[model samples]
Target: MKTIKNENIFFLGVDIGSTTFKAVLLTPKGKVHHTVYTRTKPMPDAILSCSGECHKCGRCNLGAISKTIDDFLASAGIDRENVACTITTGSQIVDGLVDFIKYDAYVSEISAHVAGARHYYPDVKCILDVGGQDSKAILFDEDMQMWMSKMSGICAAGTGAFLDSVAAKLNVPVEDMDEKVNYDSKLQVSSICAVLSATSVNKFKNRYPLGDIIGAACRAQARTVMSGVGELFLDYKGPIVFQGGVASNNAVGYYLKEITNNEIIIPEFHQVMGALGAACLAAELYEKKKKKDASYEEKSVFKVGVDELQQIIESVGGTPLAKKLGGLKNKLFVHKSDNGLEKIGIPSIKQVKDAIGDVHLIREFTDIFDKVVLRKPATDKGYFKKSIAMRANITRRELFSRNRDVPMVWRNLFYPPEILNAFGARTVTLETYAAFRARNPKKLQQCFDRAASKGYSAETCSFLRVLEGDEKLPTPDFAVTTTEPCQQGERIFADLVRDYNLENKYYTLHTPYKLSEHSVEQLAGGLRESVKEMEKAFGYKLEHDKLAEACEFSNQAREYAMQANEIRFTSPPLIHGSDAILNALVFSPGWGKPEFVELQKTFRDELIERKKEVELYTNIEDTHRLVWLHLPPFYSKKLMNFIEVTNNAPIVYEEVNHVGWDILDVNDPYVSLAKRILTVGFLDPELRVKKIAASAAH
Candidate 1:
């Protein structure tokens, strides 16, 4: 690579985002010299034919970026020789950029946005940036003087792309979307998904005026941001700076101001804040480097060969290597260090590997598992905590163990574990396994990609997608699923059976929607048939005595679970609901085992002991009690900790932890299991709502 020298008169920053290309030039004194912003364009077929071998294929976005830079320099009447340094940020910064433009440093999108906002308003405490592909919420801790950020998940809801889709569908120009807004519109757009929201807009276009539908879409975008990452702003005070391309949308700004009820500041260069921030960062770093060395060259910040750039582009477009290079380029430059003052250099290869690889994650979990299973429980710690560890240990040993001698059964969580216990088979609950794998995000994403390659739709339930992507899953002797709760579960199971050539061994129990004697008998008949099929496949007779024994164990476990729930209902927060929810075995295949019964007993006893001591498991004071409704993302605990520890809000109960059914009749195990499945709180809408209401009253 060639090194260039400059006279240190100007600094340049470029942001190559998913939807747009942006550039900003700044004078030595921090004044904006020039700026350029344009839509990002893809490489044309003629240019792509070169397969990136052409060093200067100016037909692609890279070429556009070069042109933008050239125009920026000419328009500002500045020469490259006078530019002290250049910094780059955004999603596509490293996509063959080294061949076109050289950057002295690179910064993350979050840090760049913060720098840009602080340049204009140093006291800005909160930032909500809704870009083309994703949204981010950044908060500045006054005491610590550090930046904290939350980003949206894989969904494109509330992003600029979502808005563009709605605009295109409504035949409204992108720039005119805000002007056509109906502020008082009472319509609603789905905030859960971008596709679904677009579908809603399509449906509404027929019934409602264009303005109302567009306004609802804008409101939905605001709501989506608030629900996903804006949870940080729940108790935040002071002015919030809204940055990014989407900030240009006045309707979104209006809805955000109305929702947050705070002063919203849109910087003079709102759409180019990231680029401005990068320029600011470049200026800061260049001065520091010159001062330290007395002689510093403007070296290329990123060095990517043709092959590496090709791989990066391919990964960005969702190839198998995507997870490996995802978010890596952003880490290639010096930026604000952990102390929030000092600048740090490039990260090591091992650090990158740890960030994206499953080895470290698996090892971390292994250490936890070893600590729980290999050592004696500490008397100082609550047994409820120990019980959770024990439950995890049981699950790890049973489901994950490779013991081909025992029949391996693939079953959904809704199916009774007691039936499999009678046959002495090891069970892998699809959802549970997915949750376990979710601990390693990169690995889980690989599974998702694999599933997508196998023709699974992106809209499929994430858990099922994970299963479909799972190439390491052991082939099961048989697979069973129920039709209740999740219809996708049975369909996915059938696909899995076909994939594994287990056609004769697959079973689906068609569970009825409503609970009645006739429904129970019908389900009971399906269960009986399934059991008979299993017996025939395994070449073993159905032992009534073993079935009855399994039911007795399940009943015992249920009693202990109920006792634990009663204690939780009456006492102060004894355990963090985050930890409590890990007792997934309560709803999984452990119910029929003696070890599960012991786990339940220990849990109940620990809660009783905690009640007597007047001690809270969470050392933090509980200012607010909350009931968690659904599953948490198993990938991270940051959200849970933020709620329970940072906000002092304790999730006292989780819906899944509730034991709502009565003891099973051991003599009539099939009928009892069928009744339990039918009456599950989650299966019945009215019952679920009533149970949630009753739990909240406690």
Candidate 2:
């Protein structure tokens, strides 16, 4: 009944990455030990570096790679011979070993990297590992299985090597990045490939301070990951924990933070995530191989001669037999159940480990039933009772409001923080967060398959995977790795159009506006229309949706809602009268342009006598004759200073969308202009719509 993680046996693991060499010893309980790392030296150097001596040989430098690990273990007084298992990867180092010696099981380089990442962020849907020789982002489902894996082929642009290269150029110690990257200003870096990025950084040094440039270089590198590795990914949740050696740079983390509202989690053991996975893998194998006599051990060997290896490989190289063999790993199967069936895992420790890969890498949901803990206390209740209660909601108990009745966790995840400062972005509504998580699988596979059907390779259609990650797509009923005993229906696409425009589509050529006596009615349509325009102009939609059955955060929307609330509450109150409306009337056409509010005192007095005057009592409470425009929250602190310069006339936020606002005395002529605009909506709905469209188009 004991779990694999709870066992006490130990294991050994080594990751020989294209950029660096890493080795570690791990207990079955997942404790890491005797870890070592060195920039990938030549193979001969790598072998020699593991020796106990701190000496070097001719024609090569191991650069303290293996020795570093041996010394660590020696210092801890651990005997090397006592280690139970050893597994190797990175640069196909173990691929050659498989032909000469037998391994309990062998894992591909992609699997090892994913396993490492999963150990740190179990809910991580997409993992971007930027290493020395190559970089890749592996997309996994909610179950922590690799839905698809991709590599950067031979790009050096976003990897840690770029950082090291920059450090070399800047004369900064590689280890001292923390101090050097403490930039006061942003340093521009590359936008394209690595070579270009370096050039950009160098050119940026002429005009800006070095610290600022460094900060920019950090941003450039972070963006490279997004476009390079993360570009193809879809779903990027439960949380993204950036692991690997490159993540050690705090600035890179900061730059990445700018793009993702989700706070990046850097594990305590971030740099050693891979080594730990390897060691844990070794432990699983060692524990599974029981002690036996010579005859029993002989029985464990593969029942084939050396020629079988040649035969098996040649079959994979292309004859009819090879084509058949290549496809053996990807056969489709079917499973049927109410909600579909869950996978029944293999019993062997090695097979299970590979199947599970490094769920520990993304840091598996430490406990299995985590997602099952719904946002409420009813999660533990029986289905019948839950269903009955859910169906029993009384219409009379519901409270009516323009605001959305969504839970806060769901709220915070979708809205961007900026949106909240603008009615908190609450009157703003889009898709739900839960739907987005459920639909991720569909988003990735359908797009991937469609792209593949055309000209796009798995690598080229990576954006689908990115979307899936955002949605926390569910795992396929059956993945390629572990074959199920029975067939399961393949994952399929949903009704694309219905899912895409579920909010109900409206058609309009010119424009429309809602006009009413209510003050809320006048501003609401303008805000809504302006918001939709923003969406189309950007081609970016950041709403949470309930897809099939998954739940995720509509974090962008939640944030925007908060911003809107701030804007609504912080602005000035109503001011009106004939004299107040006539004194000032001038406006600029662009956003952030200079606006001046000048009252012609002599002209105003003569003009006031000619026009009919109605007194609007100053600071009137309810039933005031005039409507007032208040300063937005962001402008409050600034206008407070402006108020001192203006001798206490309240600064008014403007009605025009783009023009900077104006400040006016309650008795100024500009007040008349304000009253005319406010009453326009109530004058006529049809005329108002035409007027609004005409004004907005300009």
Candidate 2 Cα errors over 4 Å, as ranges: 1-9, 42-76, 92-105, 120-124, 142-145, 182-187, 291-698
Q: Write the per-residue lDDT of candidate 2 for residues 1-698, one digit (tens) a residue.
A: 11345443446677767667777667655666457766654435344333443232322233333454456557646755445556665664532333322223444566666666655555566565667756676666657443576676577877887787777666676556756664556445675676666577676666766677677778877887777777555456445667778878878878777776556777776666676666666665455433221222244321222233234435335433344323432221223558876433222222222333333311111111111111111212332232223222211111112234321111111122122222122211111222232345666466555546644465532433233233332222111100111111001121221233322222111112232345334343433443354344334442312110111111222232223222322322221121122111211100011111111222223223322211121121211122223213221233332231211233222222111112212232123222233333123456545544443333
lDDT of 1 by residue, 1-698 (tens): 11224435778888888888888988777888788878876545325433564353566656766767887798889877666678888988763676677565567899899989988887788998888989999998878679999998888987898898898889889789889899999998986887877788889998998889989999999989889898888999778999888998989999999999998888889989999999998887766544422211122222233344344445235433354454554544334666664534554333433455654332222222222221212233554667768877888976788787878888887888899988999898877888778678789779888999989888899888888889877788888888867777778888888888999998998888877899889999999999988987888976999989989998898888888877777666666677777675436689788898898998888888866644312222324678888677576666775566433466778877877676898889899999888766257788677867886876
- The residue-level lDDT of candidate 2 at 521 comes to 42
Q: In model 1, where is the ten-residue run with the lowest total lDDT?
A: 294-303
lDDT of each prediction vs. the true structure?
0.76, 0.41
